[model samples]
Target: MEAMYAFFMDTAGMDEMAAHITVAVIMATIMFIVMALCAIIFTWMERKVAGFLQSRYGPMRTGRWHGWAQAVADMLKILGKEDIIPAEADKPYFIFAPLLVLLGSLLAWAAIPWAPGFVAADLDLGLFYIFAVTSLVVLGILMAGWASNNKWALYGAARGAAQMVSYEIPLLLATIPVVLYTGSLNTQDIVIAQQGGVLNWFVFRDPFLFIAFWMYFIASIAETNRGPFDMPETESELVAGYHTEYTGMRFAFFFLAEYANLFLVSMIAVMVFLGGWWSPIPGLDFAPAACFVVKGVLMVFLNMWVRWTLPRVRVDQLMHLCWKVMIPVTLVCVVGAGIWMMASGAVG
Candidate 1:
């Protein structure tokens, strides 16, 4: 941001403070716009994918080919609906929950490097910052559930809190290999470390890291409360779960935050394992940002595919998968990665 302010100062002859403010606002606006667009597009894509998977046309009449404007129409409907608070609900916490979740998702964009020299804030602890910021979403979910003053909501929130906290361990552990290999917590540095070719990517660096990648991806799906692990919002049992009492734009915020988090975790996976913005061909400097976006989109699509393909697991099964399966596997991977790094003399 300081560099951006300097560029503005040089080009526009603006004062330092004004340049700083301008850069901050511009970056914030861009991030918000990008997230909003992703939510809109993904919602449409989700419907289309669900339609094809279930053998029926999704939205075929709302806009141009295949009803592209269906998402827009849905958004307008959500916006126009009445915002209702349940009579027994804690109004303050209930209203603030969605904003908190949305804020957590948006804050994750700060350190994500879209391309070389393109990031909102290139902090030294970028990876750590992302993990820390995103954890807040769990709290928001719990708040939403508890504040609703409904037994179902409270049960969903309890399950969600447990699931998120459980999965987060493996998720953080899985990233340890990348941090150890790159020897820097900076996200751009991690990408730069994989600059040679596809083989140079962290996922290909070692067998253990490869396993770690899958583990992280699985944990991420659970962390985000997607299907097969979506006990928090198990519609069949929980009656819409945590946000059951939320209506209108308030409910829309949670919807938007979920999609935003889907993209967030996918982008993190790309950056940590898939070579990020680096071209597959060595020394080739084609559109790096485009490459990054493509990787992220593929990851997001994978999430959607799994969500539709799998049935939600029971709450006990979900907990057992995390503690008894994922955690143990990830721990072994972390230990193996450490030993491998030392044996290969890659650690300094």
Candidate 2:
């Protein structure tokens, strides 16, 4: 971005501060546009995948080919709907919840490395920053539920808060091995550590890290409230969960945040375990950003597939799986990774 500002200053003969502000705004606008497009595309893809899995056509009439414009139509319809707030709802929190959720997701993009030179912020503590920012989603969920003044919404919000908090432990634990091996918290450093080829990727480094990859993926699914672990917003039980009382563009904000989180977690998994922008071939490094996107999209596809294929678990069952199953397994993986690192003299 400094380079961008410099170029603008040189070519356009602008002041230093003006060039800096212009570059910052341009980068932010680009990020927002990219995120919005991804959300729109995934909305259509989700329905199409659901239809295929259910032995039916999805969005047949919305667009020319496979309803490519269905997402656009849905966005238009949502924008046209009335924005309604509950009569007894807490106005301030109710209005701010979705914005918080969206803000959290967008902020995460700043630290993510899409390609070699393509990170927005590149903070030394990128991993920690991601965890801190994304945790706000849970706060937004709880706020939305409580402010709605509905029992069902409150129940959903409580479940979401508990589930996200529970899963976050294993999720953080799963990344411990990557940090252990790399000895750095920066995301770009993590990705650089995994470069070389497929074998260099952390997932293939050892059995424990491989298991940790799956552990992270599972915890991420739960963290994002995807189905099979989507007890937070279980339609059969909680109506529409935390956002039950939201509508129109406000509701769309939540929807966009959900899909954005889906992509966010997938991208994190790719960067930490699957070699972020590294090409699968040993020396065939071309289109690094494309590689990252393809890998991230595949992970997102897996999330969507699992969403449509599985049934939501009971709340007690969800808690049991998190506490009794995932946490213990990830703890073992963390220990095993440490031992492997020591035994191999990989740690200094």
Candidate 3:
């Protein structure tokens, strides 16, 4: 019968859809696992790097050659700790906050374009997608602090909301040069524009764009809650910041998301300004992508290096840097880049 054929085709299509969904889920799970592994490695490496800077051994007993397994040890301890919630806190929002914060971290990787034809969902609006996803993270932090029913948590939330929102302006403006040059908002298009080599990259295009690169990089650090900008969890002032009331895995989720966000922002820096996954010098066309990965990793290590060497800046100083210095500079860069693009007949 006609009805039987329709049902049979519907069932077959459903099965195919299920298979695609399963693959997407598995790929996402792998990305999550990879983020966790990177977190563990970075934490241990941070300690070791700090020790070397301070001239002391950081975690020698936890693993072979300077405590590599220290992260694993810390992982077990964090996992075993009792999960606690404040008696007066809003139970639903408090429970939802960390997961949502971490969700932003996971959502970012979907459009990163790790390799050619290897993105989760190569949306045409990749740059804007990351911006939108990350904007939600501040909301989650605000929720966590407000729901906790604690003054310090609220203060930290307020600070995070203000800082993130402020820095994003410069970050958004600085990326304009690269976007204008690429003529497309898609991440893949940006990468393809730099295909000729390092010289063809935006950073090498002119003096103004090079300045924009640093502008974007600094704002990105502040946006991701990294050091010098991590006023959110300032122990001396606000205790553990917004998540002060959290413990166990919930606490760990925030930590994981913080580090993963760190990685995401760094990769963003690479993609937008540093030619992303392309070799810094061009040539060897066959291996250009390897260059991009190396540059990105180097940037990640640079972030870790900066985090260990510098102390955290005050909130006022952070805001000053964002509003007074970074913003104006980014505005100039945008103008300069626009002028150059028009003169060169590069604009449509």
lDDT of each: 0.92, 0.92, 0.84
For candidate 2, write residues 1-348 as lDDT tens digits.
557766899989999889867876787788888889999999998998899989998888877998899899999999999999999999999999999999889899878999986788779999989999998899999999999999999999999999999999999999988998999999999999998999999999999999999999999999999998988888887899999999999999999999989999999999999999999887888899999999999999999899899887888898898899989999999889999999998987
| Clashes (N, CA, C under 3 Å) per candidate | 0, 0, 2
User: What clash pairs does model 3 have?
Assistant: 277-292, 278-292
Residues 183-210 of candidate 1: C-alpha lDDT, one tens digit per residue = 9999999999999999999999999999
Model 3 C-alpha lDDT per residue in residues 1-348, reported as the tens digit of each score: 223334444765546556566557766887899789868877887787778878898889876776778899999999999989999999999999999999988898888877666677678999999888988799999999999999999999999999999999999999988888888999988888877677888888888899999998888888987787889889899998999999999999998988788778878888887777666555665554466556766787787677778999987899889999999998899899889999988788
Q: What is the lDDT of candidate 2?
A: 0.92
Q: Give per-model TM-scores.
A: 0.96, 0.96, 0.91
Over 4 Å off, model 2: 9-20
Candidate 3 Cα deviation (angstroms), residue 76: 1.7
Candidate 3, residue 325: lDDT:
99
Q: How close to the true structure is residue 321 of candidate 3, measured as C-alpha lDDT?
A: 93
